[model samples]
Target: MSSPRASHRGPATMFILVGFPGMEDSHFRLAFPLCFLFMVAVLGNCTVIYIIKVERSLHEPMYLFLCMLAAIDIMIALSTMPKMMAIFWFKSTNIAFDACLVQMFCIHSLSGMESTILLAMAFDRYIAICYPLSHSSILTTPRIAKIGLLAIIRGAALMGPLPIFIKRLPFCRSNILSHSYCLHQDVMKLACASIKVNVIYGLVVIIFAIGLDSLLISLSYFFILKAALGLTQEARVKALGTCISHICAVFLFYVPFIGLSMVHRFGKTHGSNIHTVMANVHLLVPPVLNPLVYGVKTKQIRHRMLRAFCRMKSC
Candidate 1:
């Protein structure tokens, strides 16, 4: 699956992954923190997912959306963490070209999935807070299922062609990537062939997908806020309370996503350090913090976790 440093004489079948630019001497030391974060992300998300699955009381629309979010976080971590850590710990930087493409697709597609699910979560919150009586009926199991299915399809359809586009181009330039993991933009940047199509399509996907989704999410919150403003002080606080966790999650995911996308699109002159750090945050922070945010911010999850731990301790 690995090969020697590829030459630029012909098409590249192997590429070098630069774990962290300007940190060659301290990669081993740096790997520790990253590995710890990876483990926490995996375990935290898994715990949240399992808790939701086994607790019948937590099977409401809000909890269901949280579960889906946790699962997506797990997938996002799995997609990039292993190979990234391998590069850091074992110094295995050579990645097969095809495998790199798969990683790229998974990262972007899953990001799209997270963005769509966040939009859906915002809608769920909107219904629950603004139209409490219809919340249950509106976000029924079948409807949630359809949203999930649509998210999957949209992510795939938008990002699936990226790898094919990259494959069609010939990579005769440098094969060194600036980040620890494979990325669509990073991969295509190495291609000696023209990438006008890739650029346009990439922008279209970003604009229509996450960009539109964020705008809609904002609109949903605008309506939710409008409805909440009509309520009494205590009632308004209670209504907005239910949305706090989701709001935190949306910021965590979108802020980094938008920042990284902008860096890729327009930060060409920026230092590689900024790009690398931004990329790591975009890939790592949401998975690490999303479940934690939900776990701490949502009372039901917090109580359930407390009770579960108390039982484990025979308290």
Candidate 2:
């Protein structure tokens, strides 16, 4: 039998954000390192977006998709990091119910958008490498715009129902979330009522939306590999070289994801700190690393980023 719920509805209540369970005293120490990561994420992603926006030479499909990725990375960082820092630094754990839902929506939807952008990037590389002569005609500016629009819409539509479903649950059990920010799964776990709908819905979204995206990205890369194999060794190296940054970006995002999923499903004895560390790795590492990887690997972006830095120093 379920324990008696608190006699209040959930909407008006404030939920608590736990920075790290059993490690509350470590929050201040944790904040310093995490703050550095967040700063790098924000600055790196912003530089990528700014460089792409202003550089007409980077108006191609691949770079445009990269711009979308950078933007989504910034959004994800903004949605979670500030609140996380507040929790760690100021002990600001209480979040209004509505505000929590808003944060959840932003985090999940932006993650979905990021996943879609990654897939779009894979497709762009496939087209560029496999159908080099037709690349320009195939991925015109109009088509690229449409592709970006679809990513935004897909994210919004899929994650839109999450908050609504979560809102219907009675949250009388406990308000303490497992992480520093609001997540749909974390919030739903606090509810006294049945969360069957929310669980099934979240699973469906993860499978069809995020999961399918990764699958498609892999398929795109498979074709790209085949195309690359047909070329001479020198030509193959050049073609694959163009995808190095993207491959690194993909690994940064998904490898941690796979690791976290494994820990969640199989390592039940693991402490909450383990989960917290893994979750943050999945959530935070890509935003901090993708810009660096791309800027280092792509010569055009490297030159432009260096130029931008030189101008800033002169000012």
Candidate 3:
């Protein structure tokens, strides 16, 4: 009989998931779509970054946040999509134990960074729309840069312990991860040892860090909306237009995230597949849609991208 550590039957059984049981054929189905999505994500985010870097007119707090967001999106895609596509296409899902922990850490760290950056953006928007005269003084270039650095540091510090904790867990069983990538919860389940501490810490981080950030973002928007309502029709329309893309992005990030958490907590067994799909969407949707949403909504970015594309073609 094969030891539990040696069996590759379930993701919970192997150090790395070689493949899924019934989903072998489904891998082929996902290959082209995943590849196409990955390319689009990378190209779209790079375009945003390029536009910010090249366009001198975009050197304000808003565009700075946009640049930070683009960078984060690139990191997000880099962390997860490459491995996922490799798994789908080449069936190379055998990530080493240490590597799996690293991947999970990177994924969650970038995700936390993205959320923090979004909150910063919300505050920037709030100041701009709610107190336009003071916005420039309050959100200078140096201050914005500092905020970006702070975002990075906060994310790294918050998620830095996850991999350490995971590494300390005894892998009495072989570590196979369900789904494509090494998510924290899935990876933790592979440990035959007690995971109450891990789970508790994870929830605490989620509640205090992500939850607090999200709540503050919502409050910022609430005040922003109230201020917008007081403006003239044209100003209100302009303000609404300016924020619509961000509002969409925020909703895209949080709604599914909260739903996934609730499902995990309350409807675990019955909603397993639903939870999985939502979790995957939570990871994929923001990176894929962020650039597109901002590009279409922000005229400056769109114009800069078009000019950049034309220049590239002419060369």
Candidate 4:
């Protein structure tokens, strides 16, 4: 009798989703909500981008990062959502090997870039809050431009090797991924060869890239909080209010991300559904909520967005 791996070897078996044991019924329930989320995420981020572009007053370091974030969300949603929707809607989850690698590259690269941009935004806030006298000099237009370019380069450099390495892995068995899209760990598990090196590399990348960035962001906020405490009560409240949205954005992205990683690493067999939910939230929540949080909290962006919307409606 042919092994399960060999049975799935032929091109004819590609995209054959051997789903989790009891997940067949759960797919429909999950699809509608996920589709609604994808639509909202795309439209929300796009509106932020449009408002920023049309309103010149909103052209500053903070809003620039917001635009970068919106762009990243668009790319990430494009990378994962359509394919996920197709799988759910049409039951046609066929993804070519090359396409899978490309998807992995785009998803991770954009995600990494967003993290880097957030770090830069944190630094921007730190300078603005802690060194108000020198904020202009410290975070000049040219400086922000350079930081954006660096974010792109850093994201590409860090994520470039992942797809290349994954492509080289001999996937002799189990092409059917449990998750919706091609995630690093999920794809690694499908490899027939030893994945010790890939796991190690992934850990190192996360530690140096995401881990280090998050650490620095936390440190920046630590100092920011300190600076805020020194100000008068009214000023402190104002400063904290300004940062609340960013704090929410940061928490939404990192907490779920860390939770997903921990669950996948330590609690995989026990709470796999919970892990799946967290992973989906990590990928979906920030994109859907970040713009809303920023727009509602930041007075200037909110005004600009409203004006843009009103003007469009009038036309």
Candidate 5:
């Protein structure tokens, strides 16, 4: 026989995602633009990946890193966007407990991977700018491959424990998640059991995975800028210009995320709708904008894109 506490716990089989809590009647209106953006994100990232694959000129370290970033963006989009659209368009908000945990794993782990790739890209830039003579040898093809592999491994190993820890806790509170996705903190709050360990581990993951990556990325940019200062004016302009898309990508991914987190923690006076919308924007904007930013800003990618478009039009 189960313990009294175990018997009193809420259903462990299902979780109801409270998607856009106040937009019960506007699902259709909301779905259109979100769906459109999702399509653009998908098509754009796919095009980037394809262009990089077929273009022999883009087989360098920087473009390889951009390709990796593009692939991660696709994973991020697929992981969250489909379910979000389902909730908005079909009212299919109920997710199995295991499924919710899986979603949590994918989103968080992939997010960590994306941040890691950004750090890697920044480091690549640093090495290219600060030590140009040794860039090719330092960031060799095999070495870049290893970096990509390590990034995935780091994300998975660190974030894999989250759902397992959450699974052990008995959720006596409501199973209704406030967001359209299964976020670590949101799901942890539903647990009736002691969550001190979970909370601590979650924070540690954030600090080590995201905080450390962001710090390293900042350090890289500092070195890159320091090196750029020693170059001629034209060279300095070119160096900084190369980083514009990446800078935009980092800003898009982190700023809204930090803003949403702050609002959740301190926005007691703010409406839940605010949190909901920010959460959606946080997930949506990066994938949608990263491709556009890169496609427009990166010369090689822009030229390749134009060539591909011309071919399509000719056919």
Candidate 6:
């Protein structure tokens, strides 16, 4: 009788995150830009959250959704950045299996939450533009809170089992993750056992989370566009203007994500550096850009930010 650990399909205890395959010598060079972007992301998202919290005027459904988006972006960034920085700057790329799974959970779950929030924002815009008189009644504070809670629960329920399933698989292949951070596909590739279950589950999660959210968001915008077309030019512009920030945020969130997915399933045999860089971009770019997009495009948030700056300077 052999020990359970002696079995070929037993669990792996740890994994090494390969920051970049052939770019190890340039880790120092990479750190400069990566660190700068990470700092910007952290500070930008913090500013967004603080402004939303402090400004009474921003307590509306639109701004509340923005607040939720910013928070999710922050969590997604924080989940991956420290470990990535460690890998790049200090060559400390090894991670415990459980820790890697936890990181994966944070990245995937928060990403799902962000997508859900984006959908909610789109719905907010739809109601405001298409049914102005009823917008207030439809998106009251209680309802908004419920939407947020449902987004969170949906993300958790979909992504929570991923790590557990991965943990059960024996990692006979190399424990080196292709990206600097933990991703479901990256981790799944290392398991020696048949990964059809993991692959199917991942695809299902993607279809339900990102796929469904994207469809609903797009549908909301379709109806929004239809309604806007019925109004005067000025009124149409006004209605469409409110959604510009959200539209940009959606692009920022989804484009890199789609790029990464395409490269993952199709470009694995391509330059490993390309894949790794895209993964980093997918994770880092959204958080840094979302707040900036909202801050610059949104008049209320921009004005409040400016006022806050002036008050701080005066003090």
TM-score of each: 0.96, 0.93, 0.91, 0.91, 0.95, 0.95
RMSD of each: 2.1, 3.0, 3.2, 2.9, 3.5, 3.6
Off by over 4 Å in 4: 1-21, 26-29, 308-315
What's model 2's lDDT at 40? 97
**In model 6, which runs have C-alpha deviations exceeding 4 angstroms?**
1-9
lDDT tens string, model 2, 82-193?
Answer: 8899889998888888999999999889988888889989998999999999999999999999999999999999999999998788766666666778778768877877
Top-TM-score structure, candidate number: 1
TM-score winner between candidates 4 and 5: 5
lDDT tens readout by residue for model 3, 1-315? 232354433323235553344567888778788778878888999988888888889888888898899888888888888887788788777777777778788888888888898899899899999989999999998899999999899988989999888877766565555567777777787776788988998998899888999999989989998999899999999987888888888888888788877776686573146656766787888888999999998999988878878999999
Best by lDDT: 1
Residues 229-291, candidate 6, lDDT per residue (tens digit)?
Answer: 999999999889989999998898898898899999998785557788789878888999988
- What is the Cα-based lDDT of residue 21 in candidate 1? 68
Tens digits of per-residue lDDT, candidate 1, 119-157, equal 999999899888899988899999998998898898888
- lDDT of candidate 4 at residue 226, scale 0 to 100: 96
* Candidate 1 accuracy as TM-score: 0.96
The collision pairs in model 2 are none
- How many residue pairs clash per model? 0, 0, 7, 0, 0, 0
In candidate 4, list every pair of residues with a backbone clash: none
Superior by TM-score: candidate 3 or candidate 6: 6
Off by over 4 Å in 3: 1-14, 18-21, 270-272, 309-315
lDDT of each: 0.88, 0.86, 0.81, 0.80, 0.86, 0.87
Off by over 4 Å in 2: 1-12, 265-270, 311-315
